[model samples]
Target: MTAQTTDPAAAARPRLRWLPRYDAPRLLAAQMSLIDQSFGIAMVGCSLAAIILAAGLMLSGDRPGALPWACAMVVACAIAYFGRLRLPGRLTEAGAARYAHGMTATLALIGALWGLVAWLYLDVRMPAVVICILSLIAGMSAAALAVFSACLPVAIAFFLPAIVPVWVVFLATGDVEYLPMFLGTPLYLCVLLVFARNYARVARQSIALRFENVELISQLREQTARAEAAQHAAEDASRAKSVFLASASHDLRQPLHAMGLFLVSLGRTGLDERQRQLLAHIEASSGAAREMLNSLLDFSKLEAGVVTPRARPFRLQPLLRKLENEFAPQAEARGLVYRTRDTTVTLHGDPTLVELVLRNLIANAIRYTQRGGVLVACRQRGARAAIEVWDTGIGIPAAQHRDIFREFHQLGNPERDQRKGLGLGLAIVDGLAHTMQTRVTLVSRPGRGSVFRFHMPQAWDAPEDTPRPLAAHSLDGLRVLVIDDDEAIRGAMSELLSAWRCECRTAESEEEALAALAAFTPGLVLADYRLRGHRTGQQALDAIRQQLGRHVPAIIITGDTAADRLRTAHATGTALLHKPVVPQELQAAIDTLLREAATQGKGAPDRQAAVAK
Candidate 1:
């Protein structure tokens, strides 16, 4: 079998959070180089003194015995000079052999010093003063390198055996005239001083560079950690969306899919008027299911940060009116009271996102309560205003308070709730609250209701205007143009409006709407956002207005919750009522528009008629 090997690049890759440790050989080499340079200068000083002695001996008269000894001293001086060439760079700080070679060369020079001294004492008249001065400078220089090299203390220990003899000779001699025999001793001392200073500078610079490298490495590691954390957060969010879609997919699709079948079934059956009304209720239930799914999809987008806020100065009371009308009928159906206490403060924030948050909270409160009530209230607090939703319901558990805010998490009780939702309501509230830099709080206990509250900044620069309560005009006898491509939806809406005593004219296209407009003008227009044959609600509404010679009040009712729908609706200043439209909400929207028309008297029509259309 052939041997297998790992890829070198793969092997070299850093482990997860690997920490670096000290290496012994590298430390030893650095220390040795510093010491060797110092000792090299020391040896040069001693060699110069030996050459001077040899010259002095040659000048002495009738001194035959001193000649061979003088020759031996000269040879020792030559050996010391050549040894510098053989030695490697800074002994203590170099690699293994380079450090060892420096130590060996230095030891040889020390021995040569001894040999020169021995030969001079035997047969030559050695200048004790000169030799002593030169040797002292050499010895001092060697001592400094030795001390500095103690950082790598092993190198300093190796030099000790060679240093002792030099000290002994200087102590033994006391001749005063011998000092003049060596003139270059001070110059040698200066050379050693220069080398010692240079060694210290090199060591300091190396350590500084190493520290900078480590600092840069630390910053890189920190940035990498931050990037990893962001990636993990994104993955967690994606998984949450997947799980939510998986769990609620069947429930959401079942009602919509069944309603289509039921409508087909109804057409085949020969139903009486009462039976037809019951079939209409089935259709209404299907529409409610579709609305809930659209709401879930909207919340998912907000939680993913795909939607941003479009905030401006607006009175808080109008938003409160919208919520009150939307939920009042549902509350009444359960025999629970719904109330609103509006504040007149001008606020700044994305009204659509804010309204969605409040709507979810209010709806949830109504779902949980058995026989109590829900309240929407607002109050001014310093630079901000607090929007609150209070309810008397099955209160949230203290332990599960936080978990309820997570996506697709519902309280695990067997008692079935009629108002089943995708359970992302609170999660969306949390996300939007974060983006707006607002805080949401919960106050509750078991068997007691919960109060959900958030704060909004006051628009201080808003035009001074007193806030007013919404008009109490019902949708009775108000004329409305209902334009839609779907005949069934159009008929259902017409029946619902007729029950509210509104004059409803149904149209399938712009041509149909224009034909209707020729005979009568409507007070308000409610249109399906998507019509047949590439036509849209706005085009139909516009054509009707042009024929009637007056701008018509309008709002868009749609099953589509795509970003384009939201953008176009807001851009045209039209109210968007997502389908299947809540009857009370639709009636309230028509009432608000008719009242506005009565107040403005149709002068230029605010160009906002394009909103719901």
Candidate 2:
């Protein structure tokens, strides 16, 4: 027992155990930062009040050391307060703890200084001065308890030092006059400590709830980002599918175009009735395949949002007449009447897209009607013209009207007959109408007939120059240049052009075409848009024009349904024809370009002279 040794580590543990423990370290750090920011103005205000109090005490002839002690306390408070303000906004748990402890020490020193003032300056004979100084100290202590209550340990550390010294001094005097102050100081400190403890608990809970809310918001943002990425992936896959369909269609159409030309050439070889009938059947089969491919291509383009409408003013009567002439043969072959009611009503819309809509509707009418005829008519409907297609076909039920416009949706053709088409006519019509910002309506009664109609705004201020019909021209004795990548296409075109009694020169590329131009001066150039070695028809035409030193009218034929290829061809300012080009359509395009070239040739000398100058 006499040789017992003291353990310093064990003794220090109990003293440090009195420090408060925080379960949430990060939350404690956040609370400390908030307290520092919120208390800047309060700190400055308290420092000023302390300086003024010290000056008043000095003027009243108080203890000599009181003024210097008060000034020292104010300086320390300013250092602690301003030092916290200069810290980085974010703090680590250890750093926050250090700051809290430092601030607590500084506040405790100030509180103790105030207590000293009360002890040293209170005059036993001057009751009014005693009351004034004691009251001021009590008020400051209450304010400190309220302000520092966000951190309980700091508030407790400050409160005890601020009030206990005054209480002890009053009791030690053993004077009955200061009995109330000694008793009341303890009660006031008790109430303030309880309130500060309650305030600290509430602050901790509030900070924790705010942290949880921040975490939830971060999770929501992450989920939104993932959803947007998935949507972009889906859109990319859809575009890839469209591209695949277009490429496949182009490859298939090349052979179909050659077959159509070959068939026309073979017809001139003088075949018998049976042979002609077989040839007709083959031609019909090829035509049916081409129609299906075209339908699918149209639907894909509309779905891809590449079909831009170029609206303009044009007379409706001419368009109706053109459709009638085009469809008259098929209707006559089917032993049905194709009627069109023409009017001089001018309408505003994209002529190409509007024609497409009408073409699909008229074709549908001709396909579905077996017993009766189809009627296309236009009527003025107050500021708009209503273009209607009425047919006595296998009428649709009310339930099927909406479904009929869906792709590959067929009514009464469950066998998916090729002759009945792929059921995309109405779908294309609906899509085209929607693109033009117009409405298409249907009125039908089952087993009777159906009427499809759409309204176009009237073009009241349209130009007076109406389009004239194109006159057919004979290609006889005309020199034509044919350029294509495929050998079969070149041979088929040569045979067809020869059948028209025209001199034909064939080339497979720009080099071959330019070489051919030295021997033959062609009036017209017909070239495939996609040629050998990745060269385009436009490039070949440009090279030929440079070699010739003049503009030669040209026509571009392509099987590509890709929107970019179509747009490029359209920009060339030359006639464009899609393949499996109908032999008639190809011949018509060639004739148009040749005739245009010849008309411009009349004034060629004047143009050439201008260029020379």
Predicted structure with the largest lDDT when compared to the true one = 2
Estimate, for each residue in 338-366, the C-alpha lDDT of model 1 and write its tens digit: 99996788888888778878988898889
User: Model 2 clash pairs?
Assistant: none
Give per-residue CA lDDT, model 2, range 537-597, as digits (tens).
8899889989999877677787877767655665565677778878777776665555555
Model 1 gets an lDDT of 0.64
TM-score of 1: 0.52
RMSD after CA superposition, every candidate: 12.1, 7.1
lDDT of 2 at 613: 2
Predictions in order: lDDT: 0.64, 0.80
lDDT comparing candidate 2 with the true structure: 0.80
Where model 2 places Cα greater than 4 Å from the true spot, the runs are: 1-23, 38-52, 62-68, 71-90, 93-149, 164-220, 272-277, 296-346, 350-352, 361-381, 386-431, 434-453, 459-471, 603-613
